[model samples]
Target chain A: MTMALAGWLSREAAVIAVPVISLAFGCLVGYLAQRSGFCSIGGFRDFFLFRHTRLLKGYAALVIGAFAAFLVFWLATPAAFEHFPWALTSGLSPVPGAPAGLEAAAYIVLAVIGGIGVGIIGVLLGGCPLRQLTMTSEGNLKALFFVIGMAIGSVIFSALVQGWVVSVMKGIAW
Target chain B: MNKEPEERTSARALAKTPVFVGALVGILAAAVQGLLASAGGPEAYGFCVACHTRDLVNSAVNALAGTSLTVAPISKNAVLPFLTIVGVLIGALAAARVNGEFRVKKGSLTSYAWYAAGGVLFMVFALLMGGCPYRVALRVGYIDIVAVIGLAGIVAGIIAGTKIAVACVERGE
Candidate 1:
């Protein structure tokens, strides 16, 4: 396949392939997500407001489905898991608890603190970025606010807050 | 843990229950994302919203800056995810069209601040947490521990944010 595409994009065919493939892949994910009505915010909202969890069950479907898929793929091609960490590579590594001392402390502090804020804000916002993107395309003009907000918030974090978080964590531990 | 049974309120029959659909979505995600990875997309690029959005923001910023800054280096050399987003829009448009749900419903000004704040918070904490809910799932797919830790915080944050939102609503602010 690489050899076949090399005719047009040269060695850069992989680069060209990324966008085309990403679009096609995204189309499938979005279509499925839409049909399944899978969304974190909607799930949480349903749980909180109306005591519904079927959408949240959709989340369960995602986990099991993705997990099985990754496991089989990894078994077939072990090389993929070799480069990255086990988890990213689709191999599970037991992380039962935090590391020892300051590093553990730092990890807990940052992770828990950041997670709380994100979860709450995400619920308040009514969905995450992916859902918002789905909504934007589906004709929710209100979701555009979220798309812009996510970009602005992320830019600020990348340009500013992320550095501060790293420095603070480093100062506290590793 | 038991509450009122959820109604099949949606127009669709399997409306309330995720059942096989969630797994189906997952299968599709894993297959396509894995195939894309084999084709050269980053492994981390598999079903990520937080990372992709941030990368796009940085890329746009870099293009606007016209000069490199001392900020962190996080963007993929190519902006493949933007196309992925476009594909999402297209897919969503098609899906909504098929459902007869492709119409816009304008919201009120009273909810504007809420919406904006929601966006701001989504970005900031997603950055701090290193992933959003879906991205965290991706992290779990990678078995990343930081995501595991952050998941707790996310639940807490949802509670706190919900409380604040409720108070604001009660006060009519």
Candidate 2:
């Protein structure tokens, strides 16, 4: 079912506003993230190694804040969040960002594999994607390379890895 | 004696902390939902690094190369691709410049190669899981069971990564 949000702008205006609003929002996020030196992967690594809560608190607050905001917005605009509390509504099915048309078990497998890879890579690289982006702006050439890799990776995934992974998972039926 | 004043000062400084910044990001993401949901669906998609990067890169590529690569519906339906990453680079650059934190740091060619490789692997895995760490938080907030599982996997991976990091350090390579 397609969602229809009681958005602030009409469809025509919203389409026009998409890039503009996203850019502005990105700026705000980038600015604050730079100031705070925020990194989700670093948070986990620090907490695991040193029992530090400083960065961990940031990550935790993000989850809590998103939950609070989503709840409030969903209540105010039901159509916007037709699947509010996704666990109750969608069950084991994931949000739509991953490969589509997989069973719950396959999704779980993909999530685990993907999550582990992300964590390992992020920790090894010293930050998450947001942190990498900010570091690139800070004139870190290594981070720049990482961001460049991501740009290249995007095309590669859509063109190659995505199809291969989906087919494999479907073939295995796991 | 002076403890109360010190505590108060630190409390005031909390506004500048990562915790506060994270909270702001979370709320603004929801605000994006309220403001732009009419643009398209994909519920908890108000903010994401990996996915949005994919959207921006693929859209630009599609337009330029005339290839029918995929992008998020919001980006596809919009007049242009989502420019969050561009904004991030520009915004962070501005912030760093203003704060006097922008400095050119170089690394060895070998390290650069590793990092570049890491980036490719990272993006691919993040997309496989469907989002980055930030989007995982949002999905968890939105109460997706799979995301919760993904979070667990991240924790497990962190533990494993920490071990590898420690091992590498001890080896002095």
Candidate 3:
């Protein structure tokens, strides 16, 4: 089958196939996320607000599953090591296009500020972006709006503040 | 312990199962991601909620600027996170269905608006921080100390939000 298909398409087609498969996988996972009610933000919110933890369990399950898959892939496939390098350094010189390394202190500050926003918004929205997607699949019309809003927000951040981000990051210590 | 009615499982019990399951799932997802990364894919990340969010951001900016660049390279990376998210939805839907918890109820218009606004806020923060709550936790599990700080911030934020929410509820405003 591989030989027959190879004959039909160029080498580029074969390379593109990986992403095609990945998209299909993404859609399937999106569907599953919609069904599962597994939002990390939601899990934390519930724990604090209602003292519930069902959503947290689902989160745990996903992490466990991914870890197991990683270990197996690592052991069985020599190529896997290449993808998961220990220190992601590509030669003594930093990659030309790589973002400047921000200071650790800056990272902490940004993370804290951003995290607060994320937490508050997530709770207000009843879930995180992942949860919103999952909720949409489960037939929550509201979540659809949330997704749209997220897209819009992403646009706003990138278009308006990317320069600022680069500058801020550059000024910070790595 | 006193047994409540059959329909009433304690919150504590319900919480335990899901947390356990979520942690396990998270670990598994990370492992697969690591493997995929090692196999000539991205490094130190197989799944990143915030990175994808940035991709979305980039795509949108390019589109508005009339550039040919696609904002989200969703098609170019390990999309397992997207899949896992979908899985959660399906799982939730199935659970809701079986438990007779499925309801087509509508919340207040104000509530819906708030939710949308909140989503926007989340996107902004996620892009700024370079990861979402799930990614933060996953990074922590992988022993990324930086992620631990993010997690701490997230928890602190949650506590603050909860308090504010309670205050709002009490005020009925």
TM value for model 2: 0.94
Task: Report the C-alpha lDDT of model 2 over B97-165, residue by residue, as the tens digit.
Answer: 988999999999998898888888998999999999999999999999999999898888888999999
Give model 2's DockQ, 2 decimals.
0.73
What does DockQ give for each predicted structure? Answer: 0.37, 0.73, 0.27
Q: A30-104, model 2: which lDDT tens digit per residue?
A: 887887888999998999999988888999999999999999988888776778899998889998889888888
Local accuracy of candidate 3 as per-residue lDDT tens digits, A10-128:
33442344334334444544534543445787777887878887776576555455545545555565343342222132322211111235555566667778878887777766777
Docking class of 2: medium
- Lowest summed lDDT window (length 10), candidate 1 chain B: B69-78
Largest lDDT belongs to which candidate?
A: 2
- lDDT tens readout by residue for model 3, B58-80: 54455567753323332233232
The local lDDT score (0 to 100) that residue B100 gets in candidate 1 is 86
Q: Rank the candidates by TM-score, best first.
A: 2, 1, 3
Error of 2 at B142 (Å): 0.4
Which stretch of 10 consecutive residues in model 1 chain A shows the poorest summed lDDT? A1-10
Off by over 4 Å in 1: A1-13, A83-107, B1-21, B38-44, B67-75, B79-82, B163-173
